[model samples]
Target: MKKLILVRHAKTEQLYDYSKSDFDRKLLPRGHKDAATIANQLKNKEIIPDLFITSKAKRAKQTAEIYAETLGYNPSAIKKEQFIYDGYTTSEMIKYLSQFNSGSDTIIIFGHNPDIAGFTVNLISDDLWHFPTSCTTVINFNIDSWKDIEVRSGKVELYIYPKMFK
Candidate 1:
């Protein structure tokens, strides 16, 4: 079986320097706390992933780092995928995930919204309109290989939001 944990990056500062790209925006104070809250919840539930993948964006990377630290995972071990930053497509995500070795039965992805939410719908055939910041959607696929994962192939396991922790 394969498990996919899709996490939306925590809340980011609304104000950004006009000179800097959106990719450079950092997380807000509440974002840090929200990230940690989810991490701690996963820790308590013993829901650790075999691999951690995140968007190259600063906010996503920071959220992934916080989760890694909270889960006692090596922050350096996190994998950064540039495609997640802009090439936010279900096909792109699946293609990237299919490249992982079969040894990795479970994985987590820290990315942006719309794409993340769309991915979930494509995988489970469920409409999740609002995938809020720092939210997580866990899906379990019966397939043995990631390549076998298809549209509506995954069963919705959990849908967690930061507000739930608060």
Candidate 2:
């Protein structure tokens, strides 16, 4: 069995300039605090991932960095992908995930929504109400390899939110 953790980036600051979509906006102060809370929670839960993949966006990258630092994992292990930047569909994320080798038993992906939300609901059989900011869904799949992952074949082991810590 392999564990796949899907995390939505923390809350972002309001957009002041329209030069870029909300995707380019950085996390707010509350978002940083919440991300740290989530990171600590993950550490307490011993939910550490062998590999961390995050979007190139500032907020998502910062979120992943918090997790990596809190988990005592080298930040260098985190991979930032350009395809995850903006407007990526759930299928694209899944396809990118499929390319990961089978050597990694645990993987965490930090990206945006409704693709993340959609992926969680569609790929896993369990009920996921929604994936709000700084929310995480951990799914376990019974497969010999990453390539064998099939849609709706995963079971939700845990769902965590920053507010839950308080």
Candidate 3:
């Protein structure tokens, strides 16, 4: 069984300019706090991934860093993908995931929605309920290879949000 954790980066500041617009938006103050809470929850729950894949965008990178740090994961294990920055569809995300080495059983993808939301809803066989900011959804699947992953191929094992911690 392989595990995939889909994380939607926390709230971000509104885009202000065209210069590096999508890549420049940083996490808001509340976003940082909420991300910290979610990171701690993942740590407390002993949810550790073998690898962390995130969009090259600042906000997504920051969120992945915080979660990896709080979970005591090596910073080097976190990889940034340029495709995630522009890929807004589930098929694109799945293609990226398929590129990973088959040895990895658990992986975390920190990215934006509706890509994250769409990916979760489309890949998992169960209802998501919610995929809000700073939320994490864990999906488990039995596949011979990552290339076999497709829409609604996995089961929703868990869904968590920062509000649940309050």
Candidate 4:
């Protein structure tokens, strides 16, 4: 069995700077706090992931870094993949996850939505209609390998949202 944790990057600055690229946009002040809140909550619950995957986007990377530090995960182990940024599809996510061997049983992915939300919906039957920023959805797949994870086959374990902590 394997556990997949889907995390949406924290809230970002709303003001659109025309000159700056979207890929470089950083998290807002609240976003930093929210990310830390979620990380601490996960730590309290002992939900440590063996693998951390995130988009190369500044916001997503920053969120992953916070979790890595708070959770005591090695910083060098975090994978910053571009496919997560450009592809933004369930297939892309599955493909990236498939690359990992069975040595790692738990994995966390940090990305933007609606891709993150969409992938969660595809994997589980629960009414997970939205993935608010800094939210984490934990799904357990009964399959032995990630390659065998089928759509709607995951059992929803937990859903952690920042607002719930407030």
- Model 4 ranges off by over 4 Å: none
Give the per-residue lDDT digits (tens) of candidate 3, residues 56-147: 99999989988988888887778988878787678877776787756788899998887788888898778775777899988988886778
RMSD to native for every prediction?
1.3, 1.7, 1.9, 1.2
Error of 4 at 116 (Å): 0.6
Per-residue C-alpha lDDT of model 2 across residues 1-166, encoded as one tens digit per residue = 8889999999998787878776578888889888889888878889889999998888999899888998887888899887766657656666777787667888998888877788888888777776779998889999767877778999988899987877
The better-scoring model by TM-score among 1 and 3 is 1
| lDDT per residue (tens digit) for residues 1-166 in model 4 | 8999989999898656688888998999999999999999888988899999999999999999989999999877898888788856677677767878678889999988878889999999888886799999889999788888778889988898889988
* Predicted structure 4: lDDT: 0.88
User: Distance (Å) between predicted and true CA of 99, model 3?
Assistant: 2.7
- TM-score, cand. 3 vs. native: 0.89
Query: Between 2 and 4, whose lDDT is larger?
Result: 4
Per-prediction backbone clash count: 0, 0, 0, 0
Candidate 3 segments exceeding 4 Å error: 16-20
Error of 2 at 25 (Å): 1.6
Question: lDDT score of model 2?
Answer: 0.84
C-alpha lDDT of residue 113 in model 2: 80
Q: Between which residue pairs do clashes occur in model 3? A: none
In the range 53-162, model 1's lDDT, one tens digit per residue, is: 99999999999999999998899999998888886678877877888866799899999877888888899966677799999888999988888888888888788888
